[model samples]
Target: MMRLTRRTEYGLMALAWLARAGGRFHSVREITENLDVPRRLLAEILKDLSQAGLVEAVRGPGGGYRLREDPGRLTLGRIVNVLEGPTIFAECYQGDCDLSPRCTIKRGIGEVARRLEAVLEDFTLEEVVHGPAGAPAPSPSS
Candidate 1:
């Protein structure tokens, strides 16, 4: 039962909304009201996005958040990494678990995580938000 966490879902939703804003900043209140999301949660999510360089934050009056990364080039994998850190098998993959000595799927779990990241990288924000007609997202520069 693999699925996106609430934070990733809300973060992705906020990004799509901001991308559609055509570069104009949108306050957390505005996004929360429009998307029916929790204000405090959204603010924290937005702060994480801002710190990750995905969105730029303008402080004070007449200020809010605007998309900074080019949506056309941004990959879902990158977003997930920023919001949730690297996808991995965690302790099991690191051989720190009690069953690491006999875990049959430990190696397989690492492979699954890598494949998942690659699949996610195949699509861009534009493709995900709009449609899948565009070419694959360019290879990550770094």
Candidate 2:
């Protein structure tokens, strides 16, 4: 059941698209049209990503958005955090459970969440773009 929200998904998709396009500034309209994502939602997600310093926004005619840093330097975890805030696998893991001190389940869940986050942190945006060469680009829907 662990899944990235639609916002994060679209953000990554847009980022990957930008990466493939090689640092080109792509307008929101172009992104929405090519990616089949909702225009309003993509705008909000792009804004969030820009605010997080993950993407850069340019204004005026012929201006648009592009990645603020190299794709190889951007981690998936960071993008997810930007779009969705901190990733927490379980509510009880946030020290909210009355039985936290004695709950074995909470401890196990925390470990799993940490491991998952670690995996995400290790995967950079570049890995998503190139996709082992001849392999087809991984679709966001996957």
Candidate 3:
């Protein structure tokens, strides 16, 4: 099964929180305390997102982090790419596979990966915050 690392998961959670907050600058302490994420790790994730241009970091007393773009413009795939590098669906599809030219399984997995990527790309941060009716919002507590 595919799984996102805690870093990516928490990063997305934090972004969703910021989006829900309407792009307000929230400090690391506030985020960690409210979301129950580890402060140090969350800080690193915020730094990475900021460097990727997905988040804007503010300095000084009342400063913190906020989304750089509108939630509707941010895709899940882009966020994943920023936080976790590239999405690799299978180890055998990494180009170093022993059956690189002969494996149908690799091709199939690659196709699935592409489809999944497309779906992820289609999902924006806004969708995550609101979710579908009856579906709970994405939150650290949930």
Find the candidate with the highest lDDT and give its number: 3
Candidate 1 residue runs with Cα over 4 Å from true position? 95-97, 134-142
Model 1: per-residue Cα lDDT at residue 124: 81
Candidate 3 is scored at a TM of 0.84
Q: List, residue by residue over 42-142, the lDDT tens digit for candidate 3.
A: 99999999999999999989899989999989999999999989877777767777755666687677778789899999999988888865376644442
Ranked by lDDT, top first: 3, 2, 1
Predicted structure 1, TM vs. truth: 0.82
**Which wins on lDDT, candidate 1 or candidate 3?**
3
Off by over 4 Å in 3: 91-96, 99-102, 133-142
TM-score of each: 0.82, 0.84, 0.84
Distance from true position, residue 28, model 1, in Å?
Answer: 1.0
Clashing pairs in 1: none
Task: Give the backbone clash total of model 3.
Answer: 0
For candidate 1, give the lDDT of residue 88. 60
Each candidate: what lDDT?
Answer: 0.80, 0.83, 0.86
Clash pairs (backbone) in predicted model 3: none
